[model samples]
Target chain A: MAKNEIKYLTAIKADKRVKKFCRFKKYKIRYIDYKDVEFLKKFLNEQGKLLPRRLSGNSLKFQRKVSDAVKKARQMSLLPYVTDLLK
Target chain B: MQLLQDLKLLIIILLKMELSAITGFLLAITNNQKSFKNDPLSLGLNSYLCRPKSVFADSFRTMRNVHWDKPPSQMLWRINRILNLPAIAFAKAGLKQKGKMNNYELMVIFTPVLSDDEFKAEQKKYAKLITDAGGSIVAENPWGLKSLAYPIQKKTTGLYWVLQYTAASDFNEKLKIQLLRDEAALRHLCTKLDKYAVEYNARKKSGAKTGTEKLAEV
Candidate 1:
């Protein structure tokens, strides 16, 4: 019974997906500036909320920077705070 | 006879000294208390001399009852003046160095209801403002009638005009105030560009021009 369980656990481990690479690091982006709206849009959802680091595959530091940049952009009306479905 | 003459001179000197001493005493009595207050040393002595014995005891009681948490107004003013030195120096430096132009990017959104001629005229008016302030326009891009993500003043569309210019740092404040006062402008943002951003913008504009030329050829 223990051998069967071990075989099942190993199969689950093998089936797990590979970790994704950070896009900013891959592109060698030194700074995540607020003015780069096109580049920043990749990290935002349809509702204008920032995607989690886990889902976006961004490094923890870069994710923080991106969130800060997004806030600044929103303050200047460069990006929307929230998207309305009816609009 | 010479002894008699010496006695006479001594009497004259004594009379002169007595007369001077009486005049000095009269002058001291007539002097205003305000004159003593102007001199720090005299003011300290005057406070001690002028106050009655009971007042001195009352002052000691007041000193014991003083709230140490809130300092005297004079001390607070002194500290505030010291803290403001850096800001004062910055203002002085800004005044001394005039006409040192810096690169700036201004993005203005006009209300979408204007005709083409009016829009062109409004653009010329802003360009004139820049020139009047000793600034030169580098590039102007009119991104006509774009839809806003959120409605501004109940308007869904706005006419966007982006301007790149070089002007003195001080001119930005004046330009911003003018934009705010203008009824035609829906919204405006002016950003000071560092050397890196300025160079990047120049390169990007050149690349865009060449790309357009190539497209036209094709």
Candidate 2:
């Protein structure tokens, strides 16, 4: 929790990558927390474009499962098809 | 008195004619039978002469008239006939490779009576069988212990598990036979999913953002 502690964000250069990729993809990162519903809503707003499997460094099998879970969440209205502009 | 009687009789006749007209109209719409725009008198006479036949008879006739001996018109009627023909032939084929049929979906309901470890063992066993049977498991999740919607063998609470898989027809037939023999599976139902349902579901899952980016909160 210390200011100078080595963070996961530092390890992945997460913020730098987010900024760099968002600009390239023309996506607006509503939030950086991937598990956050707000971040998912922002992702859905861009339509079907999902996180690159390599960037997540996840196994392809696990990535596929995750992708499918996300879709099921969206259809159930747990994730919105569009971002709430005010949020 | 005779005048009054005649008026009553006229009213009854009119009511009967109106009923016949309404019946004919409904019959035409439902059966896609060409409408008989004839007066009630004619319609009623036809009904009287030949016990009212459903206009569905027309479609039934078209189904039967497809002669293998002659060239089909290759038009809408032929198309309609072709579509209608499959259900009978498919039904006769008897669920062989039914799981492989396009749009087929299997809903496997698992109710395990064993402890968690035993259940996991059973899950692994069935999961392998499902894959080996040429069905791809699509969605699986625990519904937890719950009561059945209705009493099956006088049991109330059951451990609920659901599996959605797509399989080929013969695979399904084989799976169904296996399930019948398997003791762990309490009840199972297989229903074909519609094309639109599958497409909509796939689109909904294409991109989802959910995973812990940081260490556990606690």
Candidate 3:
């Protein structure tokens, strides 16, 4: 892929809603672009299907909301819900 | 009669200038001259005593008529337990309280991958860990899957578990150590419950038990 061609998955993660919530919550987005989705997905697989609060740096209330959103995106083929792709 | 005199003397010394009203109220309630239990007037005063600025609010609110000629330790524990209820109530009502405290409430969240069996097993392990460390298990509720503020371990939705327990000070550190080591634990929080809150709970349970008994009789 050309450098100028942005990764679609990365763009979704950096979407305004995602960034705004993450920024407000002081969480660092690890995926730079769609190119890194596979890497991030692998890391998540390692943590099991659910993520820990410290790594995500989200309050309990917001953490639940974000987890649901991730699952929804996975079901819609927006994101990979399982670990097979990363492996 | 002599015991009452000794109690009066003790209250006079312990309470100083407030002895008169305290003594009068005790006599009124204990003699059944007036039923302080569920008395609206006393309830109003009790509420007033709950305010932050009342100088002796805690003492005034918690003081009970004891046979003072008896050991102080017995009276102290009884009153302390009585006082614990309102303290918890105050905290639940969002009032900050002062004292050296012991906290026992805990919340634990887990990832979604674990099956019901796995979750129950972990819950049992954690409960045992808590009680072994001198905590009491209050309740454990499964909150089902919920969304996160951000993705974790790559996925978003995760299984949720809430556990309420009463434990000692060191229990927090012990639990955290095990949680960090376990891959299943996503998040956990522990908050201290005031002793007064515990007392309030006991009184509530007693009231509920009586109400149930009354219903059964009818």
Q: What's the TM-score of every candidate structure?
A: 0.54, 0.33, 0.34
Residue-wise lDDT of candidate 2 within A3-75, one digit each (tens)? Answer: 7866464455435543222221222211232223453443332443456754544455544644654564443
Tens digits of per-residue lDDT for model 2 on B1-218?
33443344345445656444444434433333323322444333333322213322232223223322222222222332333434333233221213223444443445536688876776677668777866677866555566543444565555655455676656667768877787766665555556544653444457532223221221
Q: What is the fnat score of candidate 3?
A: 0.00
Residue-level error in angstroms, candidate 2, position A69: 24
DockQ of each: 0.14, 0.04, 0.01
The DockQ-based CAPRI class assigned to model 3 is incorrect
TM-score of chain B of each: 0.51, 0.43, 0.44
The CAPRI-style docking tier of model 2 reads incorrect
Best candidate (score: TM-score): 1
Per-candidate iRMSD: 7.3, 12.2, 21.4
TM-score of chain A of 1: 0.74
lDDT of 1 at B157: 85
lDDT of 3 by residue, A1-87 (tens): 677975564435544543223321343321121112342343255433656766655566656645654554443333555555334
How high is the CA lDDT of each candidate model?
0.62, 0.45, 0.52
lDDT per residue for candidate 1 within A47-73, as digits (tens), equals: 788989889898987799799878866
